[model samples]
Target: MTKDEFLQFLRDPDVCKEIFEIVKKGGKPAVVAPQVQPQQKFSSIADKLKTVYPNANAPQIQPQPAPQIQPTPQPAQPPKNNAPKGSGSLADKLKFLRGHLDKVREEEQIAAAKAQEKSPAEKYTVISNRRCPICEKDTRVVKTKSRINVEKRDLDYCIHYKDFDPYLYTVLTCEHCGFAAEEKKFSGAWPNKLKETLREFLKQNDMKFPFVEERNAEDALSLFELAILFSEMTDQSKGRQAILNLNAAWVCRCEGFADRERDFMEQAAVDFEVALENERWPINGISDDMATYLCAAIYFLINEYDKSTTWLGRIMNNANLRATAPKLFEQARDMWQDIKRANKA
Candidate 1:
């Protein structure tokens, strides 16, 4: 509608009255609808209401363009794991690496501790090649003490030591044929009958070699028993058997087996008597003086004081023995005194 016509319509009393009623009924919507009348006009009704209610206190209502409803943004999807086939998450991978590193460190520590704990005997040994008499196979043996500290002697003259005792490892056993013998008798020639018997015995029995590595008192006794067995098979001198039995008794003594020790000592005394009557002097490893001294010692041990005194008297009378073996003579004299004192008591 033209502005002049709209102004002329406002001058009409009836039109003005009707427009006032619509403005009063329409409230804020009617009052503010033609807010853009300064820039662009609304509908005729809006113009009529604006003209009727041209007061500043009238509330201005905006359309707000239907609140421009923005579509609610969906949460972003997590990226797919495109890692390698065997690869895991960062946390899992770290856990695995930590465990592996801990295991490696533990192994290294154990190895270092084991190396540190190794004894001088285990670390450094005097390795010697000695051929076995029966098998002839060259076997490695720890001969002398790599670390030696010879202390006191036992009652039976067995030398005690602070380091590795060479006596404990005196027997050499062949790995092939399992022929075990004393170091002194290791090279001794065996008869054909003995060899055949040994072969048959080995075929029948599966013997465990306890003397291959570190030997205890029991292992030493076992070696002595093996030596005695080998000696018997080869028809060795009674002197060798007596000495072996004596050594076995000493080993039993060390292991605190009193009954076994006594049994072996008694067997040694019997063998020594057989050696004195039947076998020749200086038979096997025992010399004539050693045999005599051993006889005296054995008699004293067995409570045969008269026999001991007789052997001791023989040692005292032999000037050559006294001069040649001063230590043996001295030991025999001391033992003789012990025998006399025991007799008197």
Candidate 2:
């Protein structure tokens, strides 16, 4: 029993008398202790009294401390897409190719400009040279003329010197294409060797073609041929090239303002559009497919919904691409949906 209840019981003369009588009768009552209602009522009254007047001088009651809380562990999340804004891994490589192409075009333009400055009637000196199989004897070496060919057309100089002088023979032929050239007088086989050396130098310094100038205005058929050639040359480096292209595009997209961003997005769109024009199908390989999906994702991030949707659709529409890059496709679709919902909201 509580201390206060016991004290109350001690204060009651009637309760003390009954307890004394029970102890006097050898601690046994006629009825069982369970049937004792009076004692139970008295005990409850004592508990109430104790609450009303808690004895501060009496034993102090200690409260149980609250239960300790354990932190809930969270699930680990997957890595976020760190690729650039509009291009995928392949974007940078394509950009690199574009740079090379730009260099070639610039060189061609300079050469063309220089050629234009020369008067058509201006007499160009010709020198004699030995008979090369390509040009034959009596071939005259003259200034290089612009011609359309896959290899160095603008940079190549024509031979027209053999007719000018006999002793100072200087004619040379292209090793690969058998294109003939003639050198100025006072030059012998040295001209031929120099031509070979120049050819080698040009080959070594050959720059990659820019995407815009190389593929621009080209029809689907022409693009396909170029793509095929590029694929053959790229081989294992294709993935790396894609990544670099993506990086460059992403940087450009990020730094651009509204109009710039729009322009970048347009350019990105143009790339995929060209790819589609050429292939008319998703890229065959996994690495290529992933690269393509990355391109789509970049478009989405830059808010180019239509282009992004088109690219995603291309993958989803194609049974093979869809099956091969299911996760990538799903991610692109989900991100696109989120963008739509956010815009609506």
Query: lDDT winner among the candidates?
Result: 1
TM agreement with the true structure for every prediction: 0.60, 0.27
Model 1 C-alpha lDDT per residue in residues 1-345, reported as the tens digit of each score: 689977877777655655565665643333343344465655665555556456533443554777677898889989965333364556677777788789999999999998788574564456678776665677766665546676888545776666555666767677666777777677767676777887788667755373355677777787788888867866777888898888787767656688887888888878887888788878665687788788778778768788778777888999898789999988988887887788789
Q: Which has the greatest TM-score?
A: 1
Model 1, which residues run further than 4 Å from truth? Answer: 1-117, 120-128, 208-211, 302-304
Off by over 4 Å in 2: 1-245, 252-265, 279-288, 320-323
- Which tens-of-lDDT digit does each residue in 134-158 have in candidate 2? 2233432333233323222110011
Compute the lDDT of residue 9 as modeled in candidate 2. Answer: 67
